[model samples]
Target: MTGSTGHTDTRKTALVVGASRTLGLALAAEYLRRGWDVIGTVRGSGRTGLHDLAEASGGRLTVESLEMTDPDQISALGDRLARRTLDLLFVNAAITRGDLPIGEVPTDMFTEVMITNALSPMRVVESLRPLVAPAGTIGIMSSDQGSIALNTDGGQDLYRASKSALNQLMRSYAARYADDSRTLLLMDPGWVRTELGGPDAELSVDESIPGVVETIERHQGKPGLHFVDHQGQVVPW
Candidate 1:
């Protein structure tokens, strides 16, 4: 690929985890549209919208299988992609269990949410961080619900807690890798209309993802960590 400046453009590669449908699928598609080679993952072997995207991507997109909650699967993916360098690694898996009060949330449900939304993403980052280019970006799909300062409405307690935990863990990950050249981001894509966002969401995927991609691109070479929304505004911790 070549840029308008007549320089050879090194086409970047992005790994979008949990990219079967909804926001994840949109993200993968947007990256591909922006001239990025994308490796998008879906859980299980089932064909998904991502597969359809791959078919039309002119070999720029590859679909991979990943059950994010399984450590073995994560490790296997890491091994499989070990030879490739990624310009972006974004983990986009999350699940919500209704609006139950924190105390009323079942132990099993709590465990599942925490494992899926919090622990698993960090595990993926750790396992795959080495494959990221020296100046690459590492981003996690975080929500404004995770912001303690913005939690005054006090609803969706369980979901809120999981995202909060995700933010905290990403914070620690940044602290530990303080000297790394790669930029780290926790992105809030806003309430887009998707399966998780439900029918009442205020924004469409088309309205949100392009800006999210731009925000990540804007912060590329700035080291350290940032918690920002799709509009490039920083979200409170």
Candidate 2:
């Protein structure tokens, strides 16, 4: 039977990257509330929202330190977690350049956004893929902005480029791992109120996350890549 939080543990584990606050933290909390063992990462050694969640989890959550931009950190993490199995792995780190257009954005800022939103997540996935059970799911936090097919209006230029690049890169990664059994996902959680999504955003953490977690649970054991929203419907890409 599922717990009050609507998930059955079976001692299943999840590794949530970039889980310091906002949606990432919420994801960790939802999983912990559901009785799943959660390993959540914050970028640095400093205290973060995830630390608070860890303290309250009654030992179901473990907090790990990782700077997603640093490959060395990722490698060390791989060493530490080599023997453990992750039933779900989600990469949720991303940064926005404050509405800067693609051409107007500074080179350094562009680089940071792309690396954080795209390259680093893939690096983490490649390093950690072996640790996921064959039936597990690996998901990356993407946005509807990433959909090339849906970009007719065009805005959030730098942010949009980063996500679109992420979508493309993950597609390449998927092609490379075409025969792999684990389910792969590109998740679009919608425009939610958060530090990143801005206050006027339509959804709340409470509104989007349950369905997000539920969608993930429903996709278990399914293979190939899906770009889906909080409701598990496809997002064009």
Candidate 3:
């Protein structure tokens, strides 16, 4: 989706901010399936299935190393991708520790969680704003736990806080960049079975991903921070 020509079609370009794992990789594959060009970001230490996916995708996919928390790395990546504009950007890198019940939460753990789960991805989106196509979309992978209106119990203090902060930040970002077709979506992938979502999660990655893809495609023209669930319902802010 190159904005230079003002088109958001199947051949549009996509950038997935974190693709070292199942969800990001699956999203990239889905994009390639739809006949779009995809660039996925993996960490220096992680082993991504990108090579196999790229091979399968023929020539529509590419992978690069990214450290979302580092501003220099973010700038370098933006410079690298400056030539090819992006139609979609997915901020999917996040961390979660199972046990962080209120008073038991440590300071360092809280900081780390905030940095990885919230600040880093926000920075990546901000840095790549210019690359988004005119009628393109940006999605932040948030959670149901992030909804302050629905949270009656607070267990995962760090994770919850970080996501909540992300929600707020993206809401403001959407408003700040309103009046253009560049829409921002704050999506909750629901309880999917991933390394972070754990073994007993409700939805499989396959089930949740299609809904997310459809929602993103449908909402590209709309402007706002929509809290969409895996089933494509609007989650309360």
Task: Name the candidate, 1 or 3, with the larger TM-score value.
Answer: 1
lDDT of each: 0.95, 0.91, 0.85
Query: Per-residue lDDT for 127-227 in model 2, tens only?
Result: 99999999999999999998889889987898888899999989999999999999999999999999889999999998998889999999998999989
- The 10 consecutive residues of candidate 2 with the worst lDDT sum are 1-10
lDDT of 3: 0.85
Q: What is the TM-score of each predicted model, taking all chains together?
A: 0.96, 0.94, 0.93
Number of backbone collisions per candidate, in order?
0, 0, 2
Give candidate 2's root-mean-square deviation (CA, Å). Answer: 4.2
Models, CA RMSD each:
3.3, 4.2, 2.8
* Worst window of 10 by summed lDDT in candidate 1: 1-10
| Pairs in steric clash, model 1 | none
Better of 2 and 3 by TM-score: 2
